[model samples]
Target: MHAVLLLMMMVFAAVMTGCSSGPDYKIDIIKELYYQKDKPSPFEIKVTEAGKAVTGLTVTADLSMATMNHGTVKVKFAEGKDGTYAADVKVPMNGKFEAAFLLKKDGEKTEKVIEINVVKPEGVAKINGQWITDKDVSFYKFINQLQLEINRDAARKNYSGKQLEEELAYLDSQEKVLDDQNKLLTQIIRLRSMALLAEEKGHKVEAAEVDAAVEKARGQYAQFASAQALIQHYGEEKFWDVEKQQYKLIVLAQKVQKDLVDQAKKENPKAGDQEIYYQAQKQYEDLLISQINSLKIEIL
Candidate 1:
């Protein structure tokens, strides 16, 4: 009986030791951005305890300029994938910024501070004469949606263990795919910039044309039970506004392209339709490339 009692006591002590050795809470700042005025600067923070992601935590940041006497800017972070918290903070101006992060989980709170050197980046992304941070944010949202769709398809196929990991790894390593997506985004931005230039040159698309284009797009979804339901499913007000604006921009771009092609054909009256179009496209792309090359584009 005494031997059995001794063995039981040892087992209990071992269990306690294991429990006490579990992970402690920790925070890591993964990504920092250069501070810009009135622009959303994004930061990525990862929270873990014992090297495992900690979910359901409330995270916020207090940002202040380190070198100068700038007031604090408070920002609430939103939860992202893999125990990461993300927030877009706007600092007053460029300088050394100190960010103090407060993390709260289950009534327990922890604090961490990180210093970031903030300077105006030459340019991460741009088109023509316009900065495209807002457009890049929208582009990232589309990229994230595509990633989610890929994950969903993978899950549906029941890919598990090594096979699943390999599949995802392969997808991540597809530089060509990512490059193509970026090129497409750049093309879209180029088109929008061209439209803006056209507008500056006193070329405009009528509101009636935009409205007609939107109505035609809406008509494609007529099989849906209700327009309201379709709109809601696609994000309602914001989606419709963006949709209309995109259509307007596209119409303007098409008009500009047509004008350019017509001018090219007028200059070369004996040229084939294909030849004129090719020349016009080449001219447009060359102009865009020249403008882009003039800007300092730094990919972050």
Candidate 2:
């Protein structure tokens, strides 16, 4: 009986020691989970102990909600770089979620529970993780349609009756083309891509330049009553604010164009100004294509 008692005590002590082992890990949500409509949300978490990454562990998760009858979502995480594990988890809806994670390494297992929030991105597309929001696309459409109306109003002076009807009809069709979302997105992408390259090339647009460009645009629009009415409808302050941002980027893009024009002139001193400008324009287009291809663009 004494020998058996001593062996039991030893086993209990061993169990206590195993339970008291160090380096307990904790899992943290990387970001508020962004849920997709057509597929599983890309869920990510980081595992750390003593503020250091805990790696080489197998992590599996069960996602559930306390208020819902929906079955739990079983997730098998795949490790990414720097102690991050990701799983494409499909949840019933966007809201609070409890993630029960089981992390195993070297026969040692740790369980942790983290509360997560899932939401949807506000944008229809993304470039390098920067969202081009739906409202932004809507504003572009509005601007395009407004410009068409301005042209139609100007054509009223030169044409009348049937001729005026044809001109207005053509302008209306142009508005329809402008309403294409992809076409507007393409325009935005082209402008942003060129502006990005201009910044990389160390081009800077001063506030004075943006102001001058805005004034130039304002003066051009001032000639048409329809332009004034549209600007008033859009709210002059808001319209000018948006125009200032666009013109700032345009100023940057102009600098990029000027750089190409200068390079063309230097490369072909004998070429006339017209030929040089044509070559520069082609080079600018090629450069824009290359830059766009390098960007991380995603259209949802």
Candidate 3:
């Protein structure tokens, strides 16, 4: 009986030792950090072992998407005097970004998903009470940056004589695209203002849907570095605020289109399909452009 009791006590002690042997790795995600979409952004991840610092462990961050077009970004961890694990992350866009981190120590493994909400620059560029929104400015900057690029390229190649003239003519012809962009910009501003009005009138965009739509925009610009770079150039918070404005414009544009279609149907129910459709779209786009120019825009 004495021998059996002693054996049982020994086994219990061994089990307790095993349970207490390994360090409990804990990962805490810090929120609301800002980073440029084009450059590396640093994020803090706090790790604790039984509420104490877990030193000499490795941590890494990995981002995944359906298609590998954007590629992946990773950062290793270094010990900080604050007893927290620090890693720099390069967020590609203001989309549905997911990050996974791996923590390893003494043959033990831990994984965590850190939520990253990267927004476009805030106050990117604001126009009067209703002419433009942050998104319009972001997009404008993006398109203007493209124009800037063409100019840069032409300058670098030293185009002169007919070449320079031809280039100038081409640039001149692109005035329409600029016009369209300006129109779009106006529409975006109007839309944001309208959305604000809508919300005041008890209309609200579904949160999940807004999130999904924002993600869709990110997906659309996934390929264009100019777009992404300009966004990053402004930084994330402002960038996202701009994105929200863009979304509002798009929604407002759709609403305006729908209203026009409804009016056409009412005025001339038998109107030819192409006539009403074509005129409405053109008129709507024009209305927006005109309004944008009409507004007081201040750029700093």
lDDT of 1 by residue, 1-300 (tens): 999999999999999775552336677876556666677777677888888999988988888988788799898999998898887777788878887877877766677777877778554554543455645546545444445444545553778888888876766565345445466557566766667756766888899999999888777544334444545665766666777877888788777778779889999999998999999998877766665565433333
lDDT string, candidate 2, 160-192, tens digits: 999899998888778667769999999888888
TM-score of each: 0.43, 0.64, 0.35
Off by over 4 Å in 1: 1-181, 219-232, 294-300
Model 1 scores a TM of 0.43
Residue 287, model 3: Cα distance from true site in angstroms: 7.0
Which regions in candidate 3 have their CA more than 4 angstroms from the true location? Answer: 1-204, 266-273, 282-300
After superposition on all CA atoms, what RMSD does each candidate show versus the true structure?
20.7, 6.8, 18.4
Clashes of each: 0, 0, 9
Model 3 Cα RMSD, 1 decimal: 18.4
RMSD of 2: 6.8
Clashing residue pairs in candidate 2 are: none
Worst 10 residues of 3 by lDDT: 123-132
Q: Which residue pairs clash within candidate 3?
A: 119-236, 119-240, 120-237, 120-238, 120-239, 120-240, 121-238, 121-239, 122-238
lDDT of 3 by residue, 1-300 (tens): 999999999999999776553445667753233446566555666787678866777778787543335677677877675457766666666555567777777787677775566555454235552334454554665655555555645543688778778877776676666545555555445665444434444555566656777888777555555556656776767767766755655664566677677877777788898888977877666765666565554322
Name the candidate that leads on TM-score. Answer: 2
